[model samples]
Target: MRPKIENITDLRGEISRLRVQRLEQEVELTKVTARLKARLHFPVLVYTKISDFFIELFGDDPEDLNKKKENKDWVTNILRVGLPLALNRFLFPRSGFLMKSVVAMVSQKAAKNVNKDSITGIIDKVTDWIKSSKEKSRKEPRMADYGIPPDSETY
Candidate 1:
């Protein structure tokens, strides 16, 4: 009987030890799964530096309005725009320079067209209209004119 009881106690201890190990394995698996899920959801970001050598050679001086005006010619445009685009595509086939250049040009044109004074005038008009509407509402008693008591409440 004593030997049988000792064997049963040893089995129970082994079962408890196995349970602890299983729990530890489950925790590790969860951490690994979370890492894998994160990797799948968010790809790694890669940034490539564009060499300034070509820009320095072919690009126009940004501060020189005269050079910018001169670049409007077809020949200059081909040199400034066409060559860089072609070279970029040849060197880096997957580079997004075309889209970036188009967006930059469009935004620069839009910025040039925006009038600060016009925007300020519109804002002033809106504020004045709001103030006038509030004043008119306070000055006129619509409910009283309609024969409703000022203090009465209805829903």
Candidate 2:
């Protein structure tokens, strides 16, 4: 390894250099340890792992999500992601964290039932109802003078 120590002065120099090298290595070790400690910090790490577990548990497969994107099955994804969020924000706005979490879990499960076809059917029905309402509100033909008296701006 190191060249053979010759004189006393050289030995002293080598010892000083070795000590400096050891201190440098120790400093590097502390830096690495700090980085590891930050990464392993309890609350953040646990929260991340728990959230990941819940996501996987709740039928969120990475490949499936990608496939859904390719298929443009946005309705299912939106329902899954948004329904729980909407419920938590609106239905349980003032509820405690536990109740909100329960609502979110339940709504996430229920959202599975609302696929594109179901949402599209509901949308079609709503549009049809709106169209029918508009048709029903159409002005009616009647006796001309009586209708003018009712609709016209006059004394």
Q: Give one digit per residue, the lDDT tens place, for model 2 in 75-136.
A: 77787789888888887788998998888778876776677788789999999999999999
Compare the candidates by lDDT and give the number of the best one.
2
Model 2: weakest 10-residue lDDT segment is 142-151
- Candidate 2 displacement at residue 29 in angstroms: 25
Q: How big is the positional error of residue 89 in model 2, measured in Å on the Cα after superposition?
A: 2.3
Q: Write the per-residue lDDT of candidate 1 for residues 2-67, one digit (tens) a residue.
A: 223367778888788779989999999999999997886644322112324434666646566465
Each candidate's number of clashing pairs is 0, 0
- Residue 72 in candidate 2 has what lDDT? 46
Off by over 4 Å in 1: 1-95, 140-155
User: Per-residue error at 51 for model 2, in Å?
Assistant: 9.1
